[model samples]
Target: MLNMKVGESVNEYFARTLAIVNKLRANKGKIDDVAVIEKILRSMTSKFDYVVHSIEESNDLDALTIDELQSNLLVHEQLMKTHVVEEQALKVTLGESSGERGRGRGGMRG
Candidate 1:
């Protein structure tokens, strides 16, 4: 069982988990889809908690395949990336605005 890291990307986490699952299968061990799905939900980072909750509340997890869950997560991952980029851009704009004000006051004092 792989534990998800706080800063780990979804792609990395999924790859690690999939590797483990593949190893188990190669060894002829029987794995339940429900158990794997539940493990994934439980192991996800806090950032994904909302997505997990939404999935659990709106869909039948038992009926959802691993591929389906991964696809949903991929969508959220893209959203997260976009949100982060937007936030960084906003911060840069705000920083520049504040910087201009500071420089203007400094020039007047000189």
Candidate 2:
């Protein structure tokens, strides 16, 4: 499904979520800490479902801070990005290596 923050980075997603939170606070909305936390946990992309579950199971939603959640997701995002880069590099290396396998074998038969 099309969602904020889906295709966006964790930082970008949190930026959008926090903006809405701030606006609610500014308007004197009675949004409680648990409510805010739940909203964030629920609104995250499917990629973070596991992280969100871990946080929910391990911590008290009433005590978790937005900053903490954002960082948790951000770290995961960075790690996933690093892995993707590494995988791409490996693929390129393998492709080039295969193409050079017969380089010094006296060339193809005439």
Candidate 3:
């Protein structure tokens, strides 16, 4: 099983894992759907822990298909992207405010 990388997005990790699983299947290896589902859940980054927990609590892992899991993860991925954009905007706003203050202070000293 491919290990999920730090800061790796869900789509990337899912694609990698699915590739591995497909290779194993092609080689005539038997795969357990539940195990794959659990592995995906466990391999997720910490940021996805809450969503994973909610899924585990609300749904049966054995019954959930890979497509279903992917759909749910995609939702969270979008949310994460939105949050990152908001944070970047906030940082830029704060930086501009600080820059204005520094320029004003320089003017006062001159």
lDDT values for all models: 0.88, 0.79, 0.88
- By summed lDDT, the worst window of 10 consecutive residues in model 3 runs over 101-110
lDDT of 3 by residue, 1-110 (tens): 46689888888998899898999888978898888899899988888899999999999887899999999999988998999999999998998887753465346542
Q: Measured by TM-score, how close is model 2 to the native structure?
A: 0.78
TM for every model, in the order presented, reads 0.82, 0.78, 0.80
Cα lDDT tens digits for candidate 1, 1-110: 48889888877998899889889988978898888889999999889999999988988988999989988998998999899999999998998887753465346542
Tens digit of lDDT per residue, candidate 2, span 1-110? 22456578888877777777789888986777777778777878888888889989998877888778777878888988999999999998997888964476678787
Which rank order by lDDT, best down to worst? Answer: 3, 1, 2
Ranking by TM-score: 1, 3, 2
- Clash totals for all candidate models: 0, 0, 0
Residue 105 error, candidate 2, Å:
20
